[model samples]
Target: MHAIALTDGLPILDARSLVDVDLPQPQPGPHDVLVEVRAASVNPVDVKQRAASPTLRSPRVLGFDGAGVVRAVGDGVTLFAPGDEVWWAGQLDRQGSDADLQLVDERIIGAKPLSLGFAQAAALPLTTITAWESLFDKLALTDVSHGALLVMGATGGVGSILLQLVRELLPGVRTVATASSDDKREWVRSLGAAATANHHGDLVGDVLSAEPEGVDWIFSAHSAGRAADFARVLKPFGAVVSIDSARELDLDALKPKSLSWHWEYMFTRPVQRTPDMVKQHELLDAVAGLVDSGRVTSTVQTVLHGWDAATFREAHWLVETGRTVGKVVVER
Candidate 1:
C-alpha cells in the first residue's frame, strides 16, 4: 500500500516534509473496517500536527476526513460489509486516511450520502461532527426557538455547516454570523444567517445594534480572545461555546452577566475511546440523510488528486495559508 508519511516535524512549505512510502496493508482489529481510500479532505488539525507535534518512531500518516468503500471487516464488525461505501473522520491517535488503505473503527463510520460523490462526502465528516457536537451536545441549544444565536468565523469549514444546521433545526431562531468580506457575508446569508458582521471590526457593538437585548447563544469558532467580546454581547444567563484554544481567559469577566462557558472538541469521544463513540456514526447517518435530501450541501471547495507526498504537502500548505473558503479534498 502507498502512503504519505511524515518523519519529521517541519513547516508545510517544505516539499520533503511529507514523503511517499510503501508499506504493508494494515490489518483490522476486532471492531475495525479496512477501507480502500477513495477520497479525503484536509483540515487545520492536519497542518497543526505536521508543524508542531513531535516526530514519532514510525512515520505518521496524517488525514482525518475520508470517504471510501469497505474492502474488509474484522470479525466483530457488523455495521458494514466488504462492498459497503462509508465515510468518517477517523480517530486522531490512529494512522489516518492519507493512504491507499486505512483501518477505522466501524462504530465511527457511517454510510455515505447517496447524492454526493466520494470527494464531496469526504468534506463533511470533520466539520459536521464539530458543528453538531458544539451546538447540540455541548451548548445544549437544541430548542432555540425564541432567541438569537451568534456564530463567529461563519465562512470556515465548521462554521459553514453550523449555519445550515442552525437553520434546519432552529427555524424560528435568529442567526448572526461574523465574516470579514462581503462575499463571505453573502455566503453566510445564503446558508440562512439572518445577519452578518465583520469580525475585524467591533463585533459587540455590531451585534448589539442589531439586537439590543443581546443574543441567547454564542458559538465562537475563532480565537478565544473573541470570547471576552462575545461575553459582552450576550444576554444575562446566556451561554458561550468555543472550539479554539487560547492561552488564558478572564473567567471573572463573565461573572456580571452570569454567563456560562463551554468548550467543544469533536475528537474527545474518539480520542478518549469513550463508551458512546458510536454516536458519531449516528450523527453522520443523520447528516448523510440531510445531504441526500438536499437540505445540506457539501462544503468541499477544492479537490486535489493522487494521494502522494507532494499532493499531501500542497494540501497542508493550502490549509496553513488559512484562506480556503471551505474544505479541500484529495482523491486517490
Candidate 2:
C-alpha cells in the first residue's frame, strides 16, 4: 500500500513534511473492515497534527475522514461486505483513511449516500457526526422549536452542514451563523442560517441584534476564547457546546446562571470502544438518506485529484488558510 506518512516527527510543511511510503497491506481485525481508499478530505485536525512534532518509531499515517469501497470484512462484521460502498470518519487511535487501503471498525461505517460520488460523500461524515452530536446529543437540542442557536465559525465544513441540519431538523429554531466576512456570511445564509454574526467583531452584540432575547444555544466550532462573553449572552438556563482545543476557559462564568458546558469529540466513541459506537453508523445512514433525498448536501469547496502526498499537502495548505468556504477533498 502507498501512503502519505510522517517520515519524521519534525516541523511539517506541506509537501516537504509528508513523504510517500510503501507498507505491507493491513488485514482487518475481528470487527474491522478493510476499505480501498477512493476519496478523502483534509480537516483542521490534520493541520494540528502536522504542526506538531511527535516522536514515533514508524512513519505515522494521518487522515481522519474518507469514503471508499469495502475490499474485505472481518469475521465479526455483519453490516457490510466486500464490494460495498462505505464511508466513515475513523478512530483516532489507529491508522487513518489516507492510503491505498485502511482498516476501520464496521461499527462506525455507513453505506455511502447513493446520490453522491466518493469525493462528495467523503466530505460529510466527520463534520456531520461532530455537529450532529454537538447539537442533539450534547446540547440536548432534541426539541428546539422555539429556541435560537448561535453557531460560531459557520462558513466552515461542520458549520455549513450544521446550519442545514438546523433548518431541516429544527425548522422553527432561529440560527445565527458566525462568519468573518460578507461573502462568507452570504455563504452561510445559503446553507439556511436565519442571521449572521461577525466573529471578528462584536459577536454577542451581533447575535443579540438579530434576536432580542439571548440565544438559547451556542454551537462553537472554533475557539470560544470569549467564553465569558458568550456566557453573558446565553439565556440563563441555556447550554453551550464545543469541540475545539482546550484553553484557559473561564468555566466559572457559566456557573452563576447554572449554564452548562458540553464537549463533542466525534472520535470518542470509536477510540474508547463505547458500547453505542454503532450510533455513528446510524447517524451516517440518516445523513446519507438526507443527501439522497436532497434535504442535505455536501460542503466540498475545493477538489483535488491524484491521491498522492503532493496533493494532500496542497489540500492541507488550503485548509490551514482558515478562510476556505467549505470542505476540501482529494480523490484518487
lDDT against the true structure, per candidate, is 0.88, 0.87
Q: Each model's TM-score, in the order given?
A: 0.97, 0.97
On residues 31-123, what C-alpha lDDT tens digit does candidate 2 reach at each position?
Answer: 999999899999999888877756567878888889999999999999999999999999888987778999999989999999999999999
Error of 2 at 120 (Å): 0.5
lDDT of 1 by residue, 140-177 (tens): 76664678888887888999999999888877678899
Highest lDDT model number: 1
- Model 1: weakest 10-residue lDDT segment is 138-147
**Which pairs clash in the backbone of model 1?**
none
Which ranges of candidate 2 are over 4 A from the true structure?
10-14
Q: Cα RMSD (Å) per model?
A: 1.2, 1.3
